[model samples]
Target: MSKTDVSKKALLSVNDLCMYFDSAGRRIKAAEHVSFEINEGEVFGLVGESGSGKSSIGKCIIGLNRATSGSISFHGTELTGIKSRREYTEKMRDIQMIFQDPMSSLNPKKQVGQIIRDALKIQHIGKDAKERDKMAADAFRRVGIPVEYADRYPRSFSGGQRQRIGIARALAGKPKLVIADECIAALDASVQAQIVNMINEIKKETGTAFLFISHDLSMVRFLSDRIGVLHLGYLLETGTAEEIFREPMHPYTRKLLGAIPRCQCRILLRAANHSVRLSATTLR
Candidate 1:
């Protein structure tokens, strides 16, 4: 199904997700009472400034860091309540993460092909060694990376290429939900656009829901079906992309838009309008 026709089925839900840290005997509230739900086959963007707790929420969902309180559920199963090892393993396969820095996110020692194959093995996706190899090659091709370069290491590829490899690794697991935590922050402008377009294509083709965390509003506007504005550990506002851009309810949201360059702001507005038109035409 297309994004415009997305069903109301909730694929992931977070309620009162509060992640706190203690640094130097001081309590730091990274995220407080933040709540949102992602529907099946939807792209949900979480946009905020630096230190606004965007990555903290994504990390909490993926089990990198446990929340100090609150609950996170996937397909009605609370992440913290899984009683069986088998069930926990299933959950891990269902949700995958693409880290911010592709340079550091990948294994420096392994070949790019091996990296993807290793994930498939860990997730128990392919039946045999030959099958895993084929899947790994397919993953590389899917991300626009040449299969011939599979033997090369991550350090050998450019930043954009490395990010594509990271994406390939994430997709090799065939996850239902992927958390992209600032995945484009480290890339150049042209490469960032390419990755964004690639991600948009992946979402459309695979129907994989995404929690795209970023500080770039324009990129989020281009990618997100629904957006939640986060600031200083609180989710300030949420709505469809059209609503957030056309008529921002929160003052901070307006401030963010105002911060964009005038020419870029016009481009963003036009893009949003264009998206709305396309959606309407598709519905008709």
Candidate 2:
């Protein structure tokens, strides 16, 4: 039996979600019967290989892609039942997403500050323009970006900086749940560590729930409170991060853990044994 926590009030619940794509009369099952819940102030990590329907689930939750079957509920409200524009907008304000690619997600033409301000305005967050501007700068500062960098365009920033900017924009709306889809995948090793630290800090400070989707098992194990393992469009296992890593129930889950390099696996086991977070030093 899956060991996902059922004690807390679910912030976001997905039930039997199936996403299929039609191409040349053939049906592609992107996600099949995926079910999980993310509680308030919790991080639920989804781990899978490429083409394993991880991103597809994120997109479905954020309304980017409509699922073929099943239901999605946020705070007891069914997503598909929300038809009114006002209601949809209000709901979206409570849920946000950070995409995999920072450069592709951001507008190269707009200043970094403007990007954040736009989100604040769209969410109807601040009282006025000046307040919105201040919020944008604050968002930048929260993400460890200098306020001065706000004037620069996305093209001027490094990949890590751009990703931070994307995170700033996502948090500007003050969303309750953030779906971070492979958020650190595009960055270099050092930058990835920085981003991971930032994410953990942000989650602690803001009390926001996260659906952190990634292929990196080590990173997922470090970051997630609970974890779901996916393979071939199916959810194979669900458990606490410690449970999943130490005593993986599914064969696929074991296969994934076994694929880790021997040196890294040693570090992972050491960290797990000590009940410590995987540090940047050990990750290298």
Candidate 3:
């Protein structure tokens, strides 16, 4: 589809979604009445602390975990009671996930080329080994990996490079929606920036929608068109980055902003310290 067409479509929609677990004979709700919409070509950030149901919601949308009650519609089709393998495979082709830890997500024993080619083979896109190899190489190049490295194993590559491979795997299916769950958290700061930029470029080029789950508010502000804050399985607030940063309406959001180290008092203290240091240097 054209970029304009993608911009006009709502790729995924969730309504009153709830996921419950039966724990020790007591039912616990991991996600409670969560609802949101991710438009095609837009980045939606789901920010929350650990155990706030962020990953749970992602798993539900991806069909890894079953929802207790709620509706998830993808491309105008409801994702409930998908009975046939063909239907499931059709949905899988349109949606893919990039896991948090690259080291664990990839198979250590398999060659990087084989790992990436597996997705295409499963989807029946390529006819033979040679065709799959070419497809894998194309995906690797798209994610900035050198084609020669495709023969090496995941253990041979650095963390950042491994993450890039994971990204290439996710893109191999030509998915319309990518749920990136802490995709950059395991990398160093500099590497994280590089991967984030890569994701941005790919999103612009392919018009792929993203549901980015992270605790880094700064990164979320930079990448997301809209941000949602979750507190104990409840969506405390949802707004554009500017609105959430400048005029947070919820008490939880206000507390989060207040805790950020960029508050007025912290800035003033740093400025005062810098001024004192400069004065001492002048005296010397």
Candidate 4:
């Protein structure tokens, strides 16, 4: 890829994005004037405290929530403006999401393989039932699940295993980008490591861009190529993981970094070196 290619490459772009909601007859701004770009195969981390509008941005990107104002573009085409139904479907097929709770996200009534196949079917990935089943099996295997587990319900697997199923379902369509919105926050430390490692392996295999939304700065730094700090619905800082960690520019960013006790931080950062684990109490 040349510099020209790099300059022109962007999987998702947001400019002056504003999301507002009506609360008790008053207008509440969730995200205000937010602007950023997620490049091809880039893991752009959105870090913030509770109610900082981190999830709002992710939702807006995928059309889960409508934007109040401003522009959002995907692959250089305006998503917030206009598009045909087929065009929208084709573009959205390449975007997937892994929610925070696998249990809630996965249907209890459906078998694991069925769950993955639903995604494949939605994306029109496979030509027939046989091919779809094979795709589901391949997805399960890619995330380290035995093919037999596909027959079982979500209740049979542990939390980590369920999350892996969630990951497999998200990857079933071979998406170009994935939004992992606090996906690992609920898991234990060891399980967090497992999920993170699996995500890394899959990202390597697929060259997928990830909008990794989370409050864990340490973990975000570990998994993200570029990290953005959001405070009070504002983007306070954004740069490479090294730049953000080595020298944060904003006061809010500095305060978040300061929350880490130096000695404890060294240990925590060491664990984060493995690319998982919360390792922080407050990030708001």
Candidate 5:
């Protein structure tokens, strides 16, 4: 199904998700009462300034850090305080994460093919060794990586290529939801656009839901079906990408838009218009 025709079936849901940390005997609130829902086969963009806890929320979803208090569910299974390993693993198999730093996210010692294939092996995607190899090569090919490069090390690849590998690793699981945390931030603008386009194509082919976390509003606008604006660890506003870009309700959102004075109006207009053909569903 296309994004515009996405069903209202909630693939992931978060309510009152609070992630706090104690630093030097002081409570640091990273995310408080942040809530949003990602519909089936839709892109739910989360945007914020640096330290706005955009990645923190993504981490919460992937279980890198536990929620201090809140609810996170995947396909109706509650993830908060989850005690069953098998349950979490099963749900996680339907979920995968692509970290921002491709170089760091991958294992330095493992070959690129091994890295991608490991995801399938862990999930047992293939019934036999030959099938698994074919699946791994297919993933590499889909991500624009040559199957021959599978045995190469990540350190030998360029930044953009490494990012592609990271994406391939994430998709190897054939997950229902993929949390991409600033997956293109480190690359140049041109490469960034390429990755975004690649992601869009993959989404269309796979019908996967994306919780796309990024600091760049333009990028978010280009990919998101719905958007939630975060500030100082609090979700200030949420609306259709067009609504938020064309007319920002919160002062923070406006401030963020206005920060790019040179291309302020241009960015907002393009982003707003980009959403014209996108789905209308937004988090309430």
Candidate 6:
């Protein structure tokens, strides 16, 4: 597809999407007037602190949580109030989710092979058990998981391995868009880089769009083509990663950047604080 074709073809379109909950006598707005478009083959980063409604937006897009108002259209179809199982399944196939924790996402009782095959079985993609098994093994290999490990339980593997299994499962159906909610947060720093690189590679190879939600600004900058900042359930800013990073316009965006640790500056800040405290004690 040409650049214009890819830009115009949004895998997911969300407009004015709002989600609220009744907590005691007060109302909590988890997502307020959130609007964005995720184009084909683009990785969009949703950066926010906890309670900023980043994950809530992902849940609403995937149909795990209901929206109170606004619209979510996947491709050209509206997804609100989709109750039919067939319709839901079709929508889900187009948009898959990779959650933060891989261990919890997989079934403890089911073998790794069975878990990967479940989506294909449910979608009735393969004609027979042999075809399904072959497809599952291929998916596992694509995500860097050894085919032999498919028979083992999730507990048998390390965090990175389990995450690869999760990615394999998510791609088994060849979804157009994947919502990765803090998907790399649980892994070690080194493993996090590997997983992020793997995700970028897959996106480039398959032309899959990704909505990567995380609080890690640096990582998001590395992975995202575009970035959206959220604060207190509202979207503060949206722009290309370079624009947002080099010339942040929103106050919240500035604060979020300030919170990130700079090696030399952070040490200097700590030393200055310590000196100020000592001075105060002497004066008192």
**Predictions in order: lDDT:** 0.88, 0.87, 0.84, 0.83, 0.85, 0.86
True-vs-predicted CA distance for residue 246, candidate 3, Å? 1.9
TM-scores of all models?
0.88, 0.89, 0.87, 0.88, 0.88, 0.90
Q: Per-residue alpha-carbon lDDT of model 5 for 97-190, expressed as tens digits?
A: 9889876988999999998777788777778778878888888999999898999998999889999999888887688999999999999989
lDDT comparing candidate 4 with the true structure: 0.83
Worst 10 residues of 2 by lDDT: 274-283
Residue 3's lDDT within candidate 5 is: 53
Sort by lDDT, top down from the best: 1, 2, 6, 5, 3, 4
Candidate 4 stretches with Cα past 4 Å from truth are: 1-8, 81-87, 261-284
Stretch of 10 with least lDDT, candidate 5: 275-284
lDDT of 3 by residue, 114-184 (tens): 99888788877677989888878888999999999998999999999999999999988778999999998
Model 4 lDDT, residue 130, Cα: 92
Ten residues in sequence with the least summed lDDT for candidate 4: 275-284
Q: What tens digits encode model 1's per-residue C-alpha lDDT throughout 1-284?
A: 23553557989999999999999999988899999999998899999778789999999998878898999999998996566777777778889999899889989999999988988887788899899999888878889999999999888999999999999999887789999999999999999999999999999999999999998888999999999999889999888888899999987787666555446777768656654554454345
Tens digits of per-residue lDDT for model 2 on 88-138? 888888899998998799988898898888888877889999999988888
Better of 2 and 4 by TM-score: 2
Q: List the residue pairs that clash in candidate 3.
A: none
Cand. 5 TM to true fold: 0.88
Which parts of model 1 are misplaced by more than 4 Å?
Answer: 1-6, 81-87, 264-284
- Candidate 4, clashing residue pairs? none
* Cα lDDT tens digits for candidate 6, 113-218: 9997887889777788899899899889888888988889988988898888888888887889999999998999999999999999999999999999998988
Of candidates 4 and 3, the better by lDDT: 3
Better of 5 and 6 by lDDT: 6
